[model samples]
Target: MRGKHAPRSTRWPIIILVIIAVILAPIIYGASSRNRTTKNQTTVSKKTSHSSISSSSSVKSSSTSSLSQSSSSSDVKLKSAWNTTKNKQLSAFMSQWQTEMNQTYSGTYDGQKPDYYGISFPTALENGRLSGHIKFDNQNTTVEWSPNANSSAKNQVLAVAVGQTSSNGYNRILYLFIAQEKQPKVYVSQTTNGEDLYFTETQNTALKDGFSQIYNSN
Candidate 1:
């Protein structure tokens, strides 16, 4: 009887331990599960933040590139327009003068024939007056002249004329002419000597006025 009672008491202690373990098992498991969920949520949040920053950076880069391209395109368009307008004005002035001069001088003068001519826009001006260098050149010679305030001819237009002279087998010679609005005398110079020479233009008033208008507009 003593042995059987001792065995039964030992069995009761073992049963109580089993019952406590069973009650704590579910609580421990729930705590562990919550810990795992919290860890996962934290990791996902970090990844989302990193992705947002990368996306924002990409958007900013794209915007900057677009603005740069737009600015470049605008500059190109402005340059093109300027070139077009310049060519048109130059063409009109050349046509008017060439036609008038050709009609006036149909014959050669002393074995000298006018070959071709070109007019240049004023490089520098002050207070609507020419105050800079006007350059003329050909295959052989290049000449430049500066007009100042004290210059007898405060001209705005510069014309370079090329003519063939019979001396030395029809050699080419260059002549420089300057003119202004309502001015009867056209300032003249040659490559040989850059001196003050003038010729009166009683005719071709329209040509002079047209050239003056172009210069002033510029």
Candidate 2:
């Protein structure tokens, strides 16, 4: 009887352990489910952060590319209008002036080379025509010319020959123009010490008219 009763007593401990496990099973499962949910949420948050960064970077890159393209287009337009070639009349005039300047300034002046002259097409002018302000010395009048209309004169070919000289800290700029027409005429304006020293043949009606045709026509 004692042996049978002792076996029954050992079975009580095993039964108690089974009951405790049954009670704790749901708690363990709930904890595991919460851990899985937290892991999923963390993964989603990381992906969202990466996506936002990528989108921002894409926008910045697009903006930079647009600005670069705009700048390149502007440069192309400027280069297209910058004229470097001279017409027949302009070529002859440039040659004559170059010869004269070289003869007058045979050596260097003020530590710089003399007879530095060339043709320059101002980009600021419409049709890239050569135009500037001319203020004569000791005079209150300032002469200026610029094209304003897109007429036949806009299509007219014009050229400017520029001659530069400097002496004793004083600089001179010589601008010459020869209208390309049936009767080509010459116009000259010279600047020294922030003032025009002289202008040649500017009052001639025929020459003025010829120049205006090209100068006023944008």
Best by the TM-score measure: 1
Per-model TM-score versus the true fold: 0.41, 0.39
- In angstroms, how far off is 156's CA in candidate 2? 11
- Deviation (Å) of 82 in candidate 1: 1.9
Per-prediction tally of clashes: 0, 1
lDDT of each: 0.44, 0.44
Worst 10 residues of 2 by lDDT: 103-112
Per-residue accuracy of model 1 over 1-218 as CA lDDT, tens digit each: 35545633478889999999999999999999999999999999999999999999999999999999999997764343223354356455655555655422211111223332222222212232222233332222222232211233434233334434443433333333343432313332333323212233324466556644643442
Off by over 4 Å in 1: 1-6, 84-126, 129-218
RMSD of model 2 against the true structure: 13.9
lDDT for residue 193 in candidate 2, whole number 0-100 = 33
Candidate 1 at residue 171, lDDT?
38
Candidate 2 structure quality by residue, lDDT tens digits, 79-197: 43312322333344345545655522221111222231322233322332233433233433322222111122322224433444544433544443433332233455554433223
